[model samples]
Each structure stands twice: as structure tokens, then as C-alpha cells.
Target chain A: MIKVQQEDFDVSAELAALAAGNHGIGGIVSFVGLVRDLVGPDNAEPALRAMTLEHYPAMTEKKLGDIEAQANARWPLEASLIIHRYGRLEPGAQIVLVACAAAHRQDAFDSCNFLMDWLKTEAPFWKLEETEAGEDWVDSRASDDAAAARWQAKPDRAAE
Target chain B: MKILYFAWLRQRIGVAAEEFDLPADVTTIDDLVGYLTAKGPGYAKGFAEPQVIRAAVNYEYVPFDHKLSNNDEVAFFPPVTGG
Candidate 1:
């Protein structure tokens, strides 16, 4: 499953739904991303007041579906779920969620990580952080590209 | 063809979307960027750093060298920061 919405979601409820009747699944791994109240250097005070997420509606869904599909193709997963939020969100608000289930713990864990890594670099959403200083569009981090790069290096493993 | 801009690119360019006739010689994303850059200062500033600007052809991410065709919806924006 995949969703891009402005409303917040209940992670527990979502997880329950994903594993409800799946008797074969033995493990589930999940990740949740949250907005931070602070920005800039770590020592800097909390300056981030809110963040606004913008996306190409049709394109966002399409790209997310592609990422989810890749995860399924790469793992022996029973189920997967992705929920990302948009619009103006305050600090500490939930921004995204990713969950995966499989017959073993390894597949669930690995696939969840893979899904997040790809989504960070490939998803179409853009974020604008608002602070006391001013609003600024967030830049893509080189670290994210590096993380996504590791996946490309081992295509054979990913296919297995 | 339709061109769309997002985030700071949209704000800088001063428009969300626009319709343009793809010139016969504009065969790729690079060619389209060159044509738009010649339009005015707004476009020039928005695309000041072509390296940081990303393009999507018909909603799929593509490089500047990607081919173009009539009636395609092309979008240009900064690198993605979503999770």
C-alpha cells in the first residue's frame, strides 16, 4: 500500500492492518520520519517552526509506487506499506512511515531499509523549512545519495 | 509542450506552469533549458545552476540529455529532499 496525504496517521493501526491476517509473516519492520524543531548546526537553538511539503500530485504517487514495487521485487515480503504526509506541518509532526513484513526477520528489515533509502533520493516531494530567519527550500544531502548508491552497487543481491 | 516548475524554482521563475511550442531543433532536455534560459532574467536566475536543477519527463526523472517530444509534460525543479 502507498499513500500521500495531509492528514496524520496512526502507526499502530496501520501496522495492525498490514499484518492482520498474514499468518505466514513472522516479522515486521517499520520506520517513521518526523519533523524536527531544530535546524542548522546541532548547537544552534530550535529555529525551525514548521515545514511545508510540496509535490506533483500524480508524479508523487507514481514515484512512490515505483519505490514500493522495487522493494517487493527485491525481498521475499508478504506486505509493505508507505504513508507520506504533505502540506504545512509543525515541528515534531509525523512526515512519513514505511513498513514491511516477511516470513523471516531479515527480509522485513532489509526491505524496509531499502524502501527508505530509495524514497529519500527518488521521491518527488520537496520540503521548505520555515524558521525565524526565513523560509528555505531544503537541499538534497550528498549523504542520502551515498546511501542510495550502496543499493546500486549490488544489483545481484538486491535481486535475490 | 507543457513545462512545470516547483519549490524555489517555481517561485524564482514566477510561474507554476506554462505552455510552449517545442522548437523543431529543441530535441532534448538540455535544448529546452537553453531555450528557456534565453527567455528572460527570471528564467536565467531560476536555472542559474543547471547542475542543481533536475528534470522529469512525463513524471519520470530524466537527465538533461533525455529526449523530448511534442505535447510532453516536462517538469524542472531542484533535487528532491523528501523521505
Candidate 2:
């Protein structure tokens, strides 16, 4: 399942939905991303006020579906999900969620990580951060690009 | 054809989208950029840094040299920063 919306979601409820009706699923891995109050990840001061997320509405859902499909193709995933929220959000608010379920814990973990990596770079969403100084669009991080690049090296599954 | 802008590109361009009857000489995404840049100052400023601008034709990302059709809906923005 993939969802793109402006409203906040119940994390527990969403995970339960993904895990339901799958008796074979032995383990599940889920990740949630939240907004930080600091401009830099390592910064101690909280200069950031809010973040407004923008996306191409027509393309956002389709791209997320494509990412989920790619993760399923590469792993033995029984079920997966992606939920992303847009609009202005305050610090500590949830922004995104990704979960993968499989018979093994490793598959669940690996696929969950893989889903987020792809979403960070490939998804058609951008963030504009508001700070005490002013508002500015966030720049793409090189480390994030490198994170997504590493997964391209060894594809676990071949084309059918 | 329709050309859409988002994020700062939309802010700078001063419009979310625009319509154009593409000329025969404008064949690729870059060519379309060249055509629009000739329109006025807002467009010129919006597209001043071509390297940072990302594009999609029909909602799928493509190279600047990707071919275009008169019916295509092209969008321009910046690199994604979503989780």
C-alpha cells in the first residue's frame, strides 16, 4: 500500500493494516521520518520553525508505487507500504513511513531500508524549511545520493 | 503543450504552468527551455541555472535531450529532498 496525503496518520494503525491477513509473515520492519528543529542534523540550536512539503500531485503516487514494486521485485517481500504527508508541518511531526514484511527479519530490515533510500532521492517531493533567518528550499545532500547509489551495485533479483 | 513549474521554479517563474504551441525547431527538453527562456525576464531567471533544474515529461523524469511532442506535459523543478 502507498498513500500520499496532507493529514497526519496513525502509525500503529497503518502498520496493523499492512501486517493483517498474512499468517506467513514472521517479522516486520518499519521506519518513520520526523522533522527536526535544527537546520543541520548535528546542530544543537533549534533555528528551524516549520517545513512545507511540496509535490507533483499527479506523479507522487505513481512514483511511490514504482518504488514499492522495485523493492518487491528485489526481495521476497510478502507485503509493503509507504505513506507520505505534505503541507506545512511543525517540528517533531511525522513526515513519512515505510514498512516491509517477510518470513525473515533480514528481508524485512533490508527492504525497509531500501524503500527509504529510494524515496529520499527518487520521490517527487521537495522541502522548504522556515527558520528564524528566513525560508529556503533544502538542498539535496550528497550523502543521501551516495546512499541510494550503493544499492544499485548488487541487485538481488533478476528480471523475469 | 503545457509546461509546469514547481517549488522555487514556480515562485521564480511567477506562474504554475503555461501553454505553448511549440515550434518545429524545438525538438528536445533543452530546446523547449531555450524557447521559453526567450519569452521574458521571469523565465530567464527561473531557468538561469539549468544544471540544478530537473525535468519530467508526462510525469516521468527524463534527460534534457529527451524528445518532446506537442501534446506532452513537461514539468520543471529541483532535485528531490523528501524522505
Best by lDDT: 1
Clashing pairs in 2: none
Task: List, residue by residue over B11-43, the lDDT tens digit for candidate 1.
Answer: 999999999789988999999999999989999
lDDT of 1 at A15: 97
- Tens-digit lDDT track of model 2 for B9-68: 899889998898889999999998898888889899999999899999988999999999
- In angstroms, the error of model 2 at B23 is 1.9
Error of 2 at A39 (Å): 5.7
Pairs in steric clash, model 1: none
> How close is every model to the real structure, measured as TM-score?
0.95, 0.94
**Fraction of native Cα contacts kept in each candidate?**
0.87, 0.81
Q: Write the per-residue lDDT of candidate 2 for residues A9-74, one digit (tens) a residue.
A: 998998889889999999999999999777576775558899999999888888899999989988
**Can you give the DockQ of every candidate in the order shown?**
0.88, 0.87
